[model samples]
Target: MWTTLITLAIGAFGAVAAFWLGIPAPFLTGPAFLVTLCGISGIRVAIPARLRDVIFLIIGTNMGTAVTPEAVATAGKWPLSLIILSLCILAIFLIGARLLQMWFGMDRMSALLTATPGHLSFVIGLTDDLKADISRVTLISSLRVLTLTLLVPFIAPLLTGEPLPRLAPATQPMALPALAAILILATALGLLFQRLRVPAALLLGGMAVSSLAHAFSITEGSVPQWLSLPAFATMGALIGTRFGGVSFRMLAQAMGASATLSSFAAIVSLAGAYAVSQLFGIPIVTVLIAFAPGGLETMMAMSVLLDANPAYVAAHHVFRLVFLTLVLPIVVSRNR
Candidate 1:
């Protein structure tokens, strides 16, 4: 459709502009801001959800390449930080839900779903089945992502008191035979996870399979530039499309509350990041980006942009998503 083409053009412009201006994660921040402007203006633009899943598969495959044998060994020490991260996730969930309930007078189901940090689509999908406030849940979830995506780059440097590392674009290419084998394995695993009803199964499954192959010296190199770059661009477009039906008036009234709660979540994320950094000897900023409560793809893109460990960042986000998806539903169901 013409509208979709126009939307992509606007996103492309944003990406070029951001890169020209040297903003952090230009590909993501640019398209997200531009498409959000188009969406809020009532423009009819969209990206199919199925395409977004394909992008995630590519990103997951790319991230898995970072999992060398030593990285797998290091993961043995991740249990402590991961456990702390889980508790931090719980705190964020409870605090956010309570704030939404107390300040906005939202019911338990809506508040709990809206307060959850990730799995935006799955939570929104529950609205009709649970008779929750679809508008409030969508708005709050959208705001959380937009707020974090726009703010994290600025906040990250300040919190870590260090300059962001130089950009590192992966340029290596895997042979066609190796690439085909890796894709087949990853895709099969992704499909299997989907059958098991796992949240972000496509991403985590692909990542797990790819990581295993690489760790065992099966796959030789990274995902091709052709696949990875487009995946990143499409991911950016998806983030921007989130604002499609949101109104300025709705955001105006909820801005204060949402902003406060989002800030609290950010602070909590940073605290957890610091703890994990100290405990694991990783850079504070790296861990901070890893623990950032944004989309797994977006945060991993940030890690790639900031020259952080994308595998580590992806692992934390995947865990956060799975844990939230599993626990949030139960909590809401009990309260209801």
Candidate 2:
């Protein structure tokens, strides 16, 4: 309990420092950077599964709040963008896996799982079943997520020519009754999704339910800043915790591979984003945030930072995740 408190405190402090320094998306970058340092320095940082799930519920519900009728109208372009996103994911996985195999001499299974963008937990869990290299997979993946988390805030502004404020602006808060209703429904739906073996089940469930409610004019308010800011902080901290128990030597060895793969995935994602933008008239920044090969949670946070339509951005990411969930299992079975 003391350890959890200390770890959370550190994450909070990181947010304060980042905000004080006027960094964009401070609640995210700050906690992510600091707690990652704590994890690597062997300072002992851990977020319990229950607490983590609660954070997801909050963030998922918050994201749902951003759904307006205008956003629903804009979603018409999503199918084409989603098709393009699928192609990008395929490119990143196939090319990256081959690179890992050729350059690092990683085994086929390990390389394949390692090359998979996002869906880190799924990959790691499969490592044991497939007898793959958990250490290699974890090291490369941790770096990829961390690199993207730290990189996107700086990159999104430069790419979009839109300057994000250092702090997210306050909005009207959600009514408690409505909030409770959404959460209860989200939880029920999330559990159903989870039982069906869906990735990001809770988050997706919350988003789906919340979007429905918002679209129906059931509620019209933003997630309270007090709830959102800390949830964002926790999301960042979760990224950093990926480094806990990782060895420095392993991190160093995987650096080149992770960097190369991250760069390649980003380039492919950028190209796909560009193509979708041209085809559908969506902003490249928004598409990129959706199509970026980062984790769903990290990219969701980036969507908020980019001030893009959260529903539009998150839907693509959810598709990417759900697509990966289906694809990864097939590859594993085929290779075996």
Candidate 3:
């Protein structure tokens, strides 16, 4: 416990120092400290495994509210655009993974999975399950997420301007009875999807139901804003904990390669998103969230911060996660 506290203090100090020095450190304010804390204390903070599911539910609920009938109608009109964007992102990751594999001489499967800029825990767990050089994969994926999280905020504002617009104020808060009903409905939907073995379905399904309710004008009040932020912060902190488990030698080796690959990946991803945005006539910030190679939580946080279309951004990342998980393993198997 003492060590954990000290490590966290050190990480906090480091973050401040990095900011003062104008260093491009990504995890400094988020998971980086938790990683340090865990390293020093050798103590694991065991958040219930179910917490991720809950966080997803919160995210889904928030997102669902944003998808009005108008947005859905717009989406339907240009469904092909979303499909193309999703495919383009997957292609970029595949190419990037191949390039990294060549550079690092790691196994193709390990490199591919690790190089993927998806959810950190999901990637880490999948890579481990596949027995694919967990250290290398974790290192690369972590660096990718860290780089995107740090860089996107700075770049997003420059492209989209600072002080982005917020959604209009919601109507009167839902009464207690109404709020309870909504929760019950969401919970029920989540359970139904879970039983069906949908991937991240509980959260996604809950969000979907809630979103439909709002779209149809059934709920005047949206999910509370506070729900998303704290949960996302917790997710960020949990990601940082992974760094704590690394040995000094492993850390040094991973840092150099991870940094190079991540920088390259971010550049490629940003370019792809920009091009797509121009072509689709969508706001560039939306493209960035769609293309940014990071966790859903990080991207969603940025969506809120930048006042970009949070629902759109969240949808894109979620789509990417689902897409990559389904496709990458198959791709790896074929290649091997």
Each model's lDDT: 0.78, 0.85, 0.63
Per-residue C-alpha lDDT of model 2 across residues 74-143, encoded as one tens digit per residue:
8777787788889999999988899988988988898899889899988888877787878878888889
Candidate topping lDDT:
2
lDDT value, candidate 1, whole model: 0.78
Clashing pairs in 2: none
Best by TM-score: 2
RMSD of every candidate to native, in Å, equals 2.2, 1.6, 4.8
Better of 2 and 3 by TM-score: 2
Model 2: CA > 4 A from native = none
Candidate 1 structure quality by residue, lDDT tens digits, 80-176: 8788789888888898889888988888788888788878877877776796888878887787888888787777778777755434556567788
Off by over 4 Å in 3: 1-46, 119-131, 163-174, 226-228
Task: Report the poorest 10 consecutive residues by lDDT, candidate 1.
Answer: 163-172
Residue runs of model 1 more than 4 Å from their true location after superposition: 129-131, 169-171
Pairs clashing within candidate 3: 64-211
Cα RMSD of predicted structure 3: 4.8
| Candidate 3 local lDDT, 133-205, one digit each (tens) | 8767776677667667667656766787653332324434545566567667777888888797655666666
